[model samples]
Target: MSSADSSSSGFVLLGVEDVEDCALSNEGEGSLPLDRFGYVSDLVKKGNHAFRQSRLDMFEQAINYYTRANQIKPNDPIILGNRCATYLRISQFLKLRDSSDSEDRPLSGLDPTIHAELALKDAEKLGEIQSNTVRPFILKASALLLLEKYELARSTVISGLQVDPFSNSLQGALQHLEKMQAGNNGRRSHTKPERTDDFDCTLCLKLLYEPITTPCGHSFCRSCLFQSMDRGNKCPLCRTVLFISPRMSAVSVTLNSIIQKNFPEEYAERKAEHDGLTNFGADLMPLFVMDVVIPCQKYHLHIFEPRYRLMVRRIMEGSRRMGMVGIDPTTGSFAEFACEVEITECEPLPDGRFLIEVEGRRRFRIIRSRDQDGYRVAEVEWVRDLQLPDGSQERVDLLESTNNIAKHASSWLTRARQASQQDRSRYEKLLGLERMMPTPRDPERFSFWLATLTNRTPREKLDLLQLTNTRERISRALIYMRSGELGCRLDLNTITNAPPYTI
Candidate 1:
């Protein structure tokens, strides 16, 4: 209810522990509707006072009280805002209190900026995005500035200026941030690079971002730990029972400080990882270009190639995901368009080969490529259909065209089935088409599914897969069907004789 209570679960009713963790009255009771909205508001006011008390202990007390008020009226903007503010203060307090550890140097995965970012996120949830609000922008810029994301911070400030051009507070904050960035950039220093692998979280197996250290002293990415916490409140490494809520728990400040002090390079990577945007796909993945595949569809693969075998093992170890592409006949490279696929089923053989099944998740446009362990991998941006808004003229027209084309497509597939009824090889493909034909509601997905089931040459498959726009893809398929090109391509021999692929 606290707009950004990261621990908040969706749809699942809270158990007594969750409810108790959220809402407790002064008398240590469940509170259970006994606290009026007005009383909850007063608690928020007290929490704000506690935050301003200039005491670290008081700052945590502020978060506790604010959190309780939030449990009562989850949507109360004031309480949510104050709670986020309290978290930020608590973060600062912890940093100051343990600034210099004489001992092993406190290592933590705690991310303080998350509090500021979540503050703005919650503010936006209260319809603050449309309002001429200075607080949200300040909080947003604060988080970005802390992460050394000056460009984004400047842009966020500019957006705030657009809302309230005359706010001196915002204008002053912007100037101060710019000066700080200039000073930091101008500062010169040379140092030995630090190893990122040392701080890598075992879960994602990626460099840690917003790291957390549990009671058992195992550190992990905050998000990764939360995912595991969702299944059970225990550390994935040592089976140590966690005594804290993932959402309410802050990243370990001591561990982070230690990492920052000892390994500045790794610290930078951690910040960069947190700031990373997965535009069209999951981070980046290996491109499986042996064949063509479509989003929302699944494929069975036999991994015999050493490179692919390595790719599969890496995928399983990391995200269990990869991008599926086809060799471009024109350019002799991986096709520009590709589908992001996730390994759903993996079975290892006595030999080194693996029999695996993958389901496509998203479409992406490859931005850059590199060879890793004898396989092709790339960074990609997520690509989606050029969808028109609901009830709009273009939207209506596209749907109309899609529905009409679906009818035509249905008829063609039906005819192919009837004609090939005697031919088991061809009919096998057509028999499955009619029963599982995706509706035209998602023209892009429907078109891709249609293309996948068709026994077309790899060249034709790439052509369909390359079309990104939903309406354009649908139109192109419609043209293929109308011109009888699809009919010719759906031949039994053509289906059986095409190159057998593993990906």
Candidate 2:
């Protein structure tokens, strides 16, 4: 017998649509091989059931069904991918429960780390299969992210995007990287400088932090001097030619003693970390001296505003730390997430305004912001990193769908490239068309596909920000790509109204 005929006896072929309603009416009635039809039908029904259960938040039941489906079709990529997604959901639920437990209470026997590791392994294995390979890559990236290997996770995502530029999951990964990088850079630039009361620099508005005493007995922040030198080598206060070395004078013994006495906790923490006295603690600390009152995300942001600027200046002058809070997009108000900043660079503008850079090292959530000593003071709570959901089959399906879209998109790109080579002027007329052409593992192209494919409406594009899961994002993008409504427009109006700029 032929291979197809031989295989027919071992497995069932069920219509994808019929499995959704859980009707097994055709199980024994058909002339086809009993084992094959029964198995495939049963597997499909289980998948449908799992999907329904997941939507209802009956995650445990969903996981069981997904597990069974995988057993029936052990090598099936879609089934494997879906199972991984279910596993991820279970992990998330367990972690949430653990977080709610009281510190005084004894821990449960279950270990979240073990579960996460197992799920990650399964994801990696499933990623190896040719039919469902992309699923593994996406899941592996997510697993790496949960494990706190940010750089590795970012690289994995970039690699996946290279294979499938239209993947929403890869796009999400790229965005996550950008946000993390931004937060890291922001934190490094915002370190607070030392304070001196002998001479107050008019530029930064306090007794000079990182005081560089000039020949004329004036002192300014080191950063302020460097910036001033770029325009004119004159002091803002006296317009004297300010000549100074790069190094700042050492912290006076008396001021250091006073800080050690007044802020014992802060002083000790800084000293231990800086002196390498503590092997386990982080190297840097947050900006402000505020007590934490709530839990927040990994990082907090402080926008450049007027009142907060003065608050930062005062904190740098004495404590060398200042509080930060993220602004809500809806109300333009502060969120619970906050951090402490250290002013590293404080520059004086010719107009007496200060240009400063601060670094954020730790995260906190704000309980309240109160006005103190003409500056805003926040009560915050320190937060630790939260665990992500485990691997799931839905995640696998999303990855598979993304790969399907990528295959189609790449084919389109190939065609476009061929067309471009044939007629350059014709290609030029199609604005946004060139973007569809493939690049050498470009992150920008991945982002472009994500925006073009999944976001049918402006509102939908805005909603993409809310989805945390990479797989879900990719699935949404696939739906858009199949709709056949993308990359069809070239806004000639903008092209016609352009300035004299030419390519």
Candidate 3:
């Protein structure tokens, strides 16, 4: 709320003297003729006084006053902040009182954890309004520690430490939490306790975050299980052969919950650490397991392989995009030059395969590629032809050369397609090319089109695919067309490994 709005609300501005005067005025007068704002402020003051006296009833009264004030001027962050602070105090004071007693006691329907979370949320709102301070974080981390969430407590304190590194209070809290953690560790070290059949993953040596039971009935952490299986599909503990994959894990929810409830701290820490590892290099693109395609061209794909099917789903979930680089069939790895493709249409089959229609968006060069889970993923930099201003002598000469090469390449393709016209060569049966395809509008596109039509080995076509220069590609296509040395050719009846048609 704006200051003008708040000032015009007719609520009395509270001060220490006003509170003292309120107490005196009530003692003598039957009742004070106070406005709504004054009434709320009085109640808040009473709540503060009650807190000094360590009375729970007064804290509840303060909450009621703020709630009522909130209904009148709902956008006031001050009221919310006051209420949040009140809640934190109440929770802290109650815990201190309970801790002093020798006997354990249960408080019904008044879980301090819930109130602390509320205070943390209100503090977050206050931070949005002004600046985040150390008090709210301290309150929250203390509450979490009281609730036995040691790892969360440590993390919360660490965040506050980042914001205010010189905060002695935050530093002290961290030290205290570390001491508690150290005490626990020291006791665990002193005692060689008997195992309670804890299902800690042998790989991580921590309680399973998402336990996945193997075919052999032994359970492991889902990620640990997947990574182990990726190395080799065998049960890590039993050495039993297993068929497992990432993105698809059969999780044991009951076991997972059991571990979470028992080892909340370890689970929280492990999950945070594992999440960091998994999200590393998240800015990279998913590698589409297919042949090279030129930018701005339409391409169709039939996703049948299990690994590729998973990749399609992942890319579709994101920007509906993925990078395509041809496998150098010789090296069994993708080529350096790549094209990014976007899914235009997708039809899922009953047996889990998909027929997808993809369009080439633009060109990108692979900076690096690596196996993630079962499929390849890459970090790439976009490729763009060097900018040459129109009407420049160099540009005009280049355009003229590109046009001449395009005509020659077209004529060569027309003649080479004669074998298909005579029905001797089934080029039509190969890439659905009954005759020479129409030339693309741009010279760069025309070069790729001719290259795809050219009968070349997969590696040879990839060489044409890797050419980043529009002029260079046109020049290469012209040489192949004029010399008739390894020109574009297709075998319609038999499948061939080359550019254009991707399986």
- What's each prediction's clash count? 13, 40, 5
What digit string (tens of lDDT, one per residue) describes model 2 on residues 301-336?
343343444444344334445554445455566545
Q: How big is the positional error of residue 10 in model 3, measured in Å on the Cα after superposition?
A: 54
On residues 1-503, what C-alpha lDDT tens digit does candidate 1 reach at each position?
12221122111101001111233233433232232444565677777677777565576577667655554455454565555555544444333333344123332323333344444455455335235666566555544543335677788778878888986656765676576557656652445345657678899887767678776788898767755664565689999765443434456654555567677776687666544322223557687877777765667799877667656655654567888888888889778888888875554442345677787777788899988657877988887767678999888877777777677667777667678857855654454355446778877788776555444566766666666577656544544454365244343323333222110
Cα displacement (Å) at residue 141, model 1: 47
TM for every model, in the order presented, reads: 0.40, 0.29, 0.37
What RMSD, rounded to one decimal, does every model reach?
A: 17.1, 26.2, 22.6
Candidate 3: which stretches are off by over 4 Å?
1-283, 296-302, 328-333, 344-347, 357-359, 404-441, 482-503
Question: Candidate 2, which segments miss by more than 4 Å at Cα?
Answer: 1-37, 55-57, 96-98, 101-107, 131-133, 185-503
Minimal lDDT window, size 10, model 1: 10-19
Better of 2 and 3 by lDDT: 3
RMSD of 2: 26.2
lDDT of each: 0.59, 0.44, 0.55
Against the true structure, candidate 2 reaches a TM-score of: 0.29
Task: Name model 1 segments beyond 4 Å from true.
Answer: 1-281, 296-298, 411-428, 431-436, 482-503
